[model samples]
Target: MSATDWIHSFDRFDGRKGIKPGLERMEAMLLLLGQPHRDLRFVHVAGTNGKGSTCAFLASVLEQAGYRVGLYTSPYLSAFGDRMRIGGCNITDDALDALVDRVKPVVEEVAATVHGRPTEFEVITLLSILFYAQERVDFVVWETGLGGRLDATNVVTPLLSLITNVGRDHEAILGQGIERIAVEKAGIIKPGVPVLTTAKGVALDVIERTAREQGAPCYAADRDFSAKRTAYGLDGQSFDWRGIGDHHVALRIRLLGPHQIDNAALALAACVQLRRMGVAITGEAMQAGLKSAAWPGRLEIVSQSPLTLLDGAHNPEGAAALAAALKELLPNRRLIFVIGILADKAIPDVLAPLTELAAHVIVTRPDMDRAAQTSDVADAVRTLAPTTPVETMDRVSSALYRATVLAMEQRGAVICTGSLYMISEARAVLVP
Candidate 1:
């Protein structure tokens, strides 16, 4: 089959809706493929949020340390090839086509079995493992597509596991409570593996207990390692970090927001453990990686005039972070928010924080089957802030345009948020 055909075929799984959250299908596929994931060393990351940023930091640091690093993150920001990368380069179309051709029969065979069809995520996971193995990558930074315990990426026993602070997203499949969600995230903690986390309170307790039960060494973020923000602005933040080897003073990161400093601390702590495992990650490499690591669609400033910022804050905690960042960076300025979210998210909770921060809101739906209806978002805004002006548009690009116009008129700033997929479309408009 052609590369385009293979890419389009994955839509059959209906994205996250077809998520099975079990290892049987993944295990069977890996077994038939002769266990390609077995040959690769990995750092597996899981959480409701910040997991992608943590993986970005880890992969960049390992690459700077002169190792061939393969990165596997789900729900690509832009392109299909973005899901899998080796040494900072995405897997080529030719290579992907070839890999799909090889695995097509095996996937069909497995589909014919009692397990039925493997989800799109499972196929992508298998493709990533096979590609990384064939390329002989020194390390793979694997980000779970969904919850940790039963995620397809969790099939591998990684050198280190990271839970980048669990929050209450994906309540339907993973569970509604923080403790239950924490349990799902902590499931990646394998026996004897060193797992690091920044989760606090009851979630932290759940993760700590899981680590203890699994006989894994647990490194808590605040207790074991921490970052104190020394300086920050639109450019980024400089932080002093402690508990991860020699304290780095004023480590600069351009990721934006105070929350990112926490993610960076988790990454730095992971590197410390990697060093203990004889990975040869030096201080200079860590410094360089921290400065250069890039994760788009999180407080990303796309335009200087009117100051258009794009963040994928689709949940309550994420929205709170975005609000805090806006307040810290541009205090006393009115905010024009352009937002869209998936149907599965806590819609009202996600929009509530922004209501207090925004001068007005433009609601639109992303080009996805699971996107929340634009009218629903408008209704939520009315409930939260009855006086706030609300605009509804059928298209994401149109909604962004309206917000930018309003921001320019008010001499304020614009924030396009709520869904990562929608921000991808929004970014194309602003950045392109």
Candidate 2:
């Protein structure tokens, strides 16, 4: 099958089977596929935010250590093929086409079962696992799509589990409160598989309890390891990571934000566990990997002169981090935003921090059906920052171009952000 044909068929299989979360369908599908994920070693990562960035660090560091690492992530910022990759390169189109064709029959077989048809995420999960197994990559840096417990990607038992942190993002799917959300995220913990996290307070308590219940030794940030930012700018961020058995004084990361430092610290801690598990991760490779790891569409500067940037800050916590990073990096500089947010997200909470820094906000809808109405977002912008100008645009490219022109006119920076869907469109328009 061609890429377009395969993608169309995959989308048809993506509908929700039932509201109640269970892994019956996923288990049935995998069993039909001959359980390909069993022979592979993975570092499963789950969290409310920072999962992609954390996965990037792990993949880069492992690759720097001369390992053929497969990295699997979700909600691709630029391309669908980006969901699965070994090191920085995506799987070839022909390979993906063939894999989809091969898996279609098995997916059909599962669709006929009592478990019913799997979602698009489930199909992608199966495809990625099969691809990794076929390639025989040394390790796979796996990220959960949503809450971990019933997520399609959670089917694999991993070598090390890393939860970046927990927050109240997916209230409808996961639960209402942070503690409940933490429990769902902590479901990635496996028996005797050492776990690491940057979570704190109630979230930390939940994860600790889960780890204890599973007999997985739990290591945490600020307790077992931590990152202290010494200096930061758009160029990159430099921090001091208190890693296991070593005091790494200066660790540099290309990814921006203080939150990124936390992610790097968590990944660094995971590296320590991998070493204990007999993976050869040298100090030199750790430093190199930490320095080289980059996650595009997250504070990625596509244009330097006009200072146009893109970030996937779809949730409140992520928005807060983006706001803080902007204040610290470009202090007092004017910011014009080209933003599109999903309808399911907390629009007010996502806008609150952003509107404070917005010299102007051009609201637009993303490519997804769940995207919030542009007018609704503009109303929220007015409520938050009444003085800030708001303009509604239907297309991400047009909104981004308009914002860029406005930013240049006002001598300000353009930040194109909100959902990954919007960022992906903006990236393809601007960078592609």
Candidate 3:
């Protein structure tokens, strides 16, 4: 099938969506594809936020150590192919087209046999596994798309499972409270496998209990491992890792925010655990990888003209982190905010911290089915920042353009945030 044809197939599949949780369909699909997931080793990552960053860090570190690495992440910042990377490069169009073609027939057969039409995410998950196996990846770092237990990517039995922090996002699907959400995220823990996590609060307790119940050795941050910030600047963050004993190293990451330092620590700890499991990673390689790793769209400064920043702060915790980073990085400058949020997210919680920093706010909806309308988001922003001027634009591009124009007029920086969907849309329009 052609690239357009595959895209059309996915568009068609997306129309039949429902939120049923199970690995049965994915299991069947992978089994039909000769269980590609089993042929490769993986470090499965799950959490409400920071999973992509953690996965990118792990992939970069493993690659720097001279291993062929495959990284599969979701909700790409720029392109569809960004979801599947081998040796730090996005999958080529020809390879993606071929994999889609190979999977189409089986998907059709499954649909006809069991009335099981796989969702767009499920198809992408299968393609990632096939591509990883075909490329003979030494290790594949997989990030769960949503709640972990029944996610399509959970079909793999990982070398080490890492949960990056859990918060009150996706409440409807995961559950109402932190403990319930942690249990769902903890679903990725497999028997006898080692799990590493940065989960805190009641969520941390739940994950620890789950790991213990599954007979998995658990390494919780601040206990088994930790990252302490030595210093942070607009350049990057510097932190020290304490898990590898004599292998302790002071590291700097290109990614911004103090939270990123914690993410770096999580990745380093996971790498050390993998090495202990007999993976051929050295201390020198870990240092190089930590320094070189870059995950875009988390506090990413896409342009200096009017000083535009883009962040995928879709949840309360992520938004708070972004707000703190903004306060530290651009202190005393009143920020012009371009905001977009999803229908399913906790808008009040996410926008609370962000509203305090805004000199003016422009609300827009991304071109996505799940996007919250601009007017509704604007109304919410009004409640948070009553004195801050708020306007609504139907298109993200128009909102971004207007924000740049306004910020330039006022000699202020523009912050575009609220959802990954918006950041992806804004990056497409603003960067190019």
Q: Each model's number of backbone clashes?
A: 0, 1, 0
- RMSD values for the candidates in order, in angstroms, are 1.7, 1.6, 1.8
Cα deviation at 291, candidate 1, in Å, is 0.3
Runs of candidate 2 exceeding 4 Å displacement? 1-4, 7-20
| Candidate 3 RMSD to the real structure | 1.8
Candidate 2 structure quality by residue, lDDT tens digits, 155-260: 9999999998788897978889999999999999999999999999999999999999999999989888888898888899898888676666578999998899
Cα lDDT tens digits, model 1, 3-49, are 65665676445465655658988888888989988899999999888
Report model 3's TM-score to 2 decimal places.
0.96
Distance from true location, Cα of 76 in model 1, Å: 0.7
| Model 3: per-residue Cα lDDT over 248-298, one tens digit each | 678888899988887889999998998888888988899899889988898
Candidate 1 stretches greater than 4 Å from native:
7-18, 244-249
**TM-score per candidate, in order?**
0.97, 0.97, 0.96
